[model samples]
Target: MDKKEDKHKVAEEPMEHTLDCMSRLETMSDEEWNEFFSDKNSMSDCSFLLGYKEAKLRKEAIKPNAEKAWQHFHTSYIVPETTRRHMGIWIYPLATIAAILAIVFILKFVHLNSSDIDVSRPFMAFTADHAPQLITITEDGSRPNIIEGRQQRDGILINDKEADFTHASFAKKMIRSIATPRGKSYKIILNDGTMVLLNAESKLIFPTSFVGKQRNVRLIGEAYFKVKHDTAHPFIVQTEKVNTRVLGTEFNLRAYPTSDTHVTLISGSVIVCNRSNNKAIKLCPGQDATLLGNKDFDITTVDTDYYVQWKDGYFYFDDLPLVEVMKELGRWYNVDIEICDNSLLSYRLHFIAERQASIDQVVENLNGFSYLSATRQGQKIIISKKMHLKSD
Candidate 1:
């Protein structure tokens, strides 16, 4: 034979030996196996076997049909003598790895095929004319299936079979938004067990699953959060003007685009800061922080219950201004408010009214206590100072 042919023949010998050794693993005596592993020349071959075992264990842990898939692979692919002889024993482990990967792909394919559609896509889409009361938006901006969540005592009940947000594949960095339109509210339990009460005319943008160093969510309008504490990963709430950082705490944040952003600490501690100015204020229980514009933050001691009372089915106002009260009412009742008399804006009111009450009922209740009357014009409500009749 030529020199090149001899070189090729020599290279094939070690691969043949390795494959021969691997195929005999089941039948080999313990002493023979030990001797094979102990041999310095067989170190590379033994390493391949150990790596394959590790991969097999991992597949078994995550995939229920891993063993069955392996058996099928062995029968169809590994038992073929032509493939083994041509590819050689050194390639045997690689072939097995490929087979395992194929099993994973098949399993994923089956899972996707079994479902009606991909629920991992975004929630329902909203337009200027049409807005869903409550919807979730996916990462890619696609609206997926609209799940009608049922309200529970502690949280909302979403169909668990629709999507598993906590799965590792879904936990990767992906943006999602859950929103509530006017006259509606929603409660949700996140993958990390954090409970959030979303108020009307509010939207929260978060990851379907939080990955990386920090768990973060962006909020518009208002929400009351019962954050899940993880010392290793800090939870962050980002608004238009401020970011609230907490390890684990109960707090309320209101950040309407047209109004000032407010943060009220209910329990534990939080660091509220503006990214624009880097001005941060640490809030203790019973303290409230308001971000005025993008430059100034006002922190003061306030009644925490008054700020978060909307989540408890009551609109509890303590000396809140009439304009502010109307704004809150309008949001819940899905009405546009126009104050006819500017003097009535200065009227301060204190009352606890059920949120479920109609706008007419609320307006009537207010007129009984204050010198103002509200008139409904279609979806708009006009409030003015009540004109008294002169003595006839």
Candidate 2:
């Protein structure tokens, strides 16, 4: 045969092989399927033969049994082969299963094309690790002596060095501050046994070890506090505009630089006092106090879950304004959100989503319930109203 004819015949071989394999699969009993998959060379040959384009199966709808076959093969036939000679048997099953899954996935993609897949709500499609938590500065205007942490079952575990409180060196009172940049969070146990969950873009400054009568710390961002009760020595969280005093209680404090400061009491009574005016307000469980930019305090009843959900690795928005929602998303995703229209800010949305979910997934969920659209350009996410198509 001539070169052109031989080339055509070679091209047709893969297609013919694919058809033959499919025909065999149609009549393959459980024992035969196992036998076919049990052989390494045959499995490899099947994989090469079933290449998507060569099979000419892209245009065909996935067979109803494809999913069932995949499930059965995945759970039963894909097992480890003891002999080294058949090691490829173990690997080839996975490749064949992946090829089968691709077909099912392609069918779903084709089916969804007719359904609504909102393009305006673009998702990031990629995942990113949480930003690193760092010790920016320490008391005495120096850096931390040592900073170390590791992932644990509960969360990231921060290591703390024990200080000799009784020694004369401790009399000097050393303060240490740890900060988590945008897109990361950390949990640290203070020297006093108080546990603090610091949210992204937040900082906590406390002594290397508690000393004297008062256990005090200054906060520059948001944190959930589980203070260790010391009746004789009160725990104080000093913010930019307010100070929260607690003997023993669970509460969440938010004091972002550009936003109003808030203290939400979860389980105990605490006093939130304004720094400038020394005006103090006692908050009960489920109560929240907001310190406005003007230093005016607004006390109201609130669901504490909405405030402390970040510690639990979720963003829980309950009738929260669109602007506020975007602000929170921007912080956790480490992106800039620009709202093109001010009216969108008035729209309220309520949803609960994992903090680690990609920005695209969040935007998709958001667009599903609201008339909003988000587009990303570099690190900025632009929000606007979704355009409606008129029906003829």
Candidate 3:
């Protein structure tokens, strides 16, 4: 977007050439090619890199000697000789070098002004030193970010070399809760080779890996975990209010900052515990544990799928209160849900959709039984109690 940056953008050229650059390079001898492309550091200087690249669309199009193709490639973009040099090479009889350069410059500039960017270029790489370039992603209506390798490098800490993290296996010991922001998730392969998916606005930080005896991962927000079976070490998920321990199993934890934590076990044995008095309750398949942030915590045996559906494409609700259902909806829909009608808060519904679904679809589906209307004013989507008529 700046003048300095604009100088580096490649000017496009017509792709109607009958001869292929790669084929021509392939026909040349390897020795000649090696001598030509030995040191190609000026790649950014010659602006035809993208144009030369498009000229060799696919690998199959290169039918000439490999060396010749490489030499042409290196020469055309890497280290091009002026037209004066071309004149000495028994070509282009009395053509002025200045005229040829001007023509090339005009053509490339005009082409670039008329076309879109060449997306084939791996924008995340630098050709000069083969460095991996930093990528910045600023999705619409979200925070702008410059992150690398999923983790944003904290500039001050990295520059000062002050940050330190101890590597420990996640087993047995007590782990505190953790959380993440929107448009973010974490992938952690446990010490026992179990995988955990920490969803957005969630956090789970325990031992560096897994150590001691049991596999433990603290949970805050929501997460879907696959525990690895080990006779010696059992896996556990700890929350601010409850603790979930298991050996080999799959389960989900929903504990947002504004709501009570819910532990739903799907396919294996688990124990949900109270942190205050160390009270423990073992759970089997089709079981659910609810821990309020206040004091009282309850457990019941219901259709576990109803609780675990959010982990999949389904958002299932079975006789759930409106406040509770609104919490779950808030997480997946990435919106702050407000309940204006206390009378309608007791209504419950069951529905399923992929995580990337529109908020309108969710509202329309859940409002099938009641009169609920929604309107978006900026980032906030307001849901109000309305009457469901014969038609939408």
Best candidate, lDDT-wise?
2
RMSD of 1: 29.6
Residue lDDT tens for model 3, 1-392: 98855643423322222123322434657555343334233222222443443343332243435445434432322222322332233232122322223334433454332123221221110012122222223322255344343232322111111111223323344333333455345455543467676676666665544557766666777878888788688777777877788878888887765556778888888888788778787877778888754455677887877765655556677766555556556655556554443334435445555566677776666656555655554434555557432121
Look at candidate 3 and tell me the lDDT of residue 374. 53
Among these predicted structures, which one has the highest TM-score?
Answer: 1
lDDT, candidate 2, 194-239, per-residue tens: 8888888888887767778999999999999999989999999998
Cα error of candidate 3 at position 190, Å: 2.0
Q: Can you list the residue pairs that collide in candidate 2?
A: 123-360, 139-175
Ranking by TM-score: 1, 2, 3
Q: Model 2 off-target regions past 4 Å? A: 1-139, 143-172, 389-392
Worst 10 residues of 2 by lDDT: 77-86
lDDT of 2: 0.68
lDDT of 1 by residue, 142-173 (tens): 77445554322222235411222333244245
How many collisions per candidate? 3, 2, 23
Of candidates 3 and 2, the better by lDDT: 2
Worst 10 residues of 3 by lDDT: 155-164
Return whichever of 1 and 3 wins on TM-score. 1
